[model samples]
Target: MRLLVVEDDRTLAGLLHKALTQEHHVVDVAHDGREGRELARSGVHDAVILDVMLPSMDGVEIAHQLRAEGIVTPILMLTARDGLPDRLRGFDAGVDDYLSKPFAFEELLARLRAITRRGAPVEDECLVVGNLVLDRRAHEVTRAGRPIDLSLKEYALLEYLMRNPGQALSRTLILERVWEYSFDSFANVVDATIRRLRKAVDEGYEQPLIQTVRGVGYKIKAQ
Candidate 1:
């Protein structure tokens, strides 16, 4: 998965980038709030790891701006202050998860997984679509107890579909929610991703859960 790391602290930012990259994720680093906001608004990232203290603008303000513009990318806020009021402020500014400094990298990873998993339906640390199961914590997917490997984008697309269940999601809605500001991109990446997701999730299933709505979009339902 691609992730944006917004931090003013060079040392911490470097460490985070290295750690996240080691996990096979693409890490984009920004040293200040303005650059972070610009990259985040580009809508190319799966998630954002943001620091509360930044130059030009703070993380809270950046998050508020993103939310105001209808950007729903899951934000994980990093703060040195562990006060209740500070955490409350971060939540109010639209942070999905919070981690204080001097934290374990394992804890950070756990929180990231938890928040991203919660963003979709199918809880219990895994996503369930009929007999298919996706273990978010383990990053594993199985159908009829058989393991299936998927790319990060495919996993994200499938999770979104499963979370919404029977809701008919428009292409525009999917692009906005999953791809950030996808209007400028000329490629039909969303369609391609959906096709790949369907191949993995429904190729051998008795009844396909994903349904196309002609010219509209797609929906996932049991029946």
Candidate 2:
């Protein structure tokens, strides 16, 4: 499962990122509310770990807007406010669960699992970008009706890109999502895999979909 952690405290966010990655979930971190809302709205993540009292917008408002827009992705809010009114407000805004701060990591993990099990979002099995098609259920890739064979890493990279088409994904983010290691030394692995994936998906095609975003990373878009 891919989880989004929307937290302002960098230390806690990093801790959550590390622990969740170790638990085998691809994690994305956003320090501000606006960015968190944007990522949560992407519909690419299995769940979100949201923090209340965020800049630009609060977690409750974010949940309200997403629910109003008809996004059913599960949200687990982390907040220090544990009053009955606060809890009711959170529920009214459509948060799946709430965890007060200074709580146990074990409890957080448990609650996250529980909510996700009950409210898992249903998504389309096929991921499409232009002529490229990736069938998640079949675990197959095709472009313009031509079959394309990919290694495990290549397929994951492609799926991640296709899941967030038109968005620049940094090398660090890609490494975190596609590979187990989040260290900087493994950044080159992403570049090497991208090259191989590019060869497989775009070499023979006109109007290639894979794009190199200078000084940032890569994005996939329909030509």
Candidate 3:
């Protein structure tokens, strides 16, 4: 998954980026709340790990702004403030989850997975299109109950496609949602990633779930 980690603490931010990258997640780091808010508002990240005490805007305000703009990307607020009032404020600001400082890395991972899982209404914790199942929480994909491993970019692309199952998603839409402002129409990164995603998601399946709509774009649906 693509994640945004917002922390003013340089060491901790670096640590998180390294750890999450090692876990096969594409992580972008922001050292202050203002920059974090900008990135978050772009609506690219699958999830956000935000620290409350930040330079400039602060995490609570960032959350509030995101919600005000109608952005529903899941945010997990990290804070040293374990006080009930502080936690409550974070929630009121539209944080989906909260984790106090000095927390275990495993716990953070689990919470992130939990937040992303609850974003979808499907009860299985796995998105299904035909016989294919995408376990967002587990970061695993299965076809006919057989496991398929995907790269971080491939996983992000597939998850986006699955979330909007059957909708014709243009390449421009996919680029804006998945890669943020990093690439434009000239970038073939989207095509390459989609090719890889298609291979992993449809290679062995009897019917391909991803379909091209001539000049329009792509859509995922059971054939």
lDDT of each: 0.81, 0.86, 0.84
Q: Which is better, 1 or 3, measured by lDDT?
A: 3
Q: In candidate 1, what are the lDDT values of residues 1-223, reduced to their tens digit?
A: 5679999999999999899867866567889899899889976566899999999999999999999999888899999999999999889989998998989999988887777666554444566878878675566779889888888667767766776778888888777656544573623787888888889878977798789988778888753
**Which segments of candidate 2 are over 4 A away from where they belong?**
119-156, 161-191, 196-223
lDDT by residue for model 3 (101-127), tens? 899999999999899877455664567
Candidate 3 CA-lDDT value: 0.84
Q: For each candidate, what TM-score against the reference? A: 0.60, 0.64, 0.72
Winner on lDDT between 1 and 2 is 2
Top TM-score hit: 3
Q: What's every prediction's RMSD, in angstroms?
A: 6.2, 6.7, 3.9
Candidate 2 minimal-lDDT segment of 10 residues: 116-125
Give the higher-TM-score candidate: 1 or 3: 3
Q: Give the per-residue lDDT of model 2 (tens digit) for 44-121.
A: 777899999899999999999999999898899999998999989999999999999998989998998798778333
Cα lDDT of candidate 2 equals: 0.86
